[model samples]
Target: MRLINLKPSRTNQLILALLPFLALLLAYALGSTARLAENPSDKLLPALSSIADAVNRLAFVPDPRTGEYLLWSDTLASLGRLCSALGISTLIALVFGMVVGMFPYARALLAPFFAAVSMVPPLALLPILFIVMGLGETSKITLIVIGVAPIMIRDLALKVMELPREQTVKAETLGGNSWQIALRVVLPQILPRLLTCLRLQLGPAWLFLIAAEAISADSGLGYRIFLVRRYLSMDVIFPYVIWITLLAVLTNVLIDLVRIRVFPWSELDKAS
Candidate 1:
């Protein structure tokens, strides 16, 4: 009965995890009901059925203008841009991050430049991106890359620098040159860190993607959300926002699985 080690059972942990979300839903439902009771045409807080119907329409029904379900189309478009940008960012971070972190010359040359670039607010460059890259997919993807890559680089670089110097010295003693040491030693150690960096960057990457899509894009989750805002379609907007959150959560989970499966040592090292 001591308070020092009061760990909840798994069942209790599950309930605790779900409690806040359940409370939020109940609060929203009550508020929606109260609002609807006062004004039948309230769009600010649509009823549950309204949200369900909006989800059905967007997800199940094909758009009249285009022969595609709007929800699926928007999800696909957004996922495509997000995945492409993240893939590119991962490669860039792995290469440049390793180089910058491992080599004093590279760090001296690129670290300050990247540091300055990272300071420039990614959103502020949206106008310039749109102008230079045109109102196309390139701009949206580029926006995400610019938003997340520098920070990813910095993080991975720091991770590399944090590696025990003894490992590098030992590798050198084994006749490994700079290139061989980076590829054989630093690369393996930083792979897990790169994944960690990507997981951390997902939120900002989504933000940049959404902003670019909201400002100028034919179709995306953000574009759809902003599009419905003109008509005050809370039902559509709410479901879309939930969908985006779910996607982000699922992606992070997948990344976690990959880290655990592919780099099991990373977790064990941390635990030890």
Candidate 2:
């Protein structure tokens, strides 16, 4: 069979999906063993046992000073900022995307501006945000919004513009006004794409959030990682990084599920 036509069975697919992760774990274990054998005081590539201990301390044990589980607290703080910023970004994208996609004059005025804005690196604006908004949750959340919103806006706008022109014409033929057509037609068609855009932006959104948190924040996964780095706490840092990855993966999965549940027709559209 040609490579293009070859497909794995479900069991083979599952095994293939797991192979890379298993290899990664095995490599880390071997590296850690070798490093520790050479130098028992090695701080890098900590053994899995040490990582487990750190996870227990961070996730299960409460801090002596703060009396709160560090991992859970950090997760909450990071997620609060992430969700708030993404929510704001989604609203902004939906409104502006629709306006730009549906109205030529609005598109002429705003599309180029947003397209340029999206090109600017979000991290470069971190200092400005901190100086202007101050080193608070607001600045962190704003950084994430600034990083992800413009791209999302552009993506959603393109999706809206790509929608079949015939749908709008049919709506107009039914005597639907501009507002009616937008409300009944454009919004529904672009919502699935909106979710997809949000999904695509999640990684950048997390990057911006972590950058902001590392630079200025009292509590967050990023802050904790940076705080511990002074002492070369690889065990803690490693688990925190893994925890962040797991969270992002969970979020991506949840978003896909919600999209499938809410917009089953989008899947059918894709199949066709």
Best-performing candidate as measured by lDDT: 1
- Give all TM-scores, in the order shown: 0.98, 0.98
Candidate 2: tens digits of C-alpha lDDT, residues 79-194: 99999999999999999999999999999999999999999998998889889989989989999999999998898889888989898899999999999988999999889889
lDDT of 1 by residue, 1-272 (tens): 89988999999999999999999999999999999999999999999999999999999999998989999999999999999999999999999999899999999999999999989899999999989989999999999999999999999989999999999999999999999999899999999989888999999999999999999888999999999899999999999999999999999999989998999999999999
CA displacement after TM-score superposition, residue 61 of candidate 1 (Å)? 1.1
lDDT of 1 at 171: 100
lDDT of each: 0.95, 0.94
Report the CA-based lDDT of candidate 1 relative to the real structure.
0.95
Cα miss at 83, model 1 (Å)?
0.8
Q: What is the lDDT for 257 in model 1?
A: 90
- Runs in model 1 deviating more than 4 A are 1-4
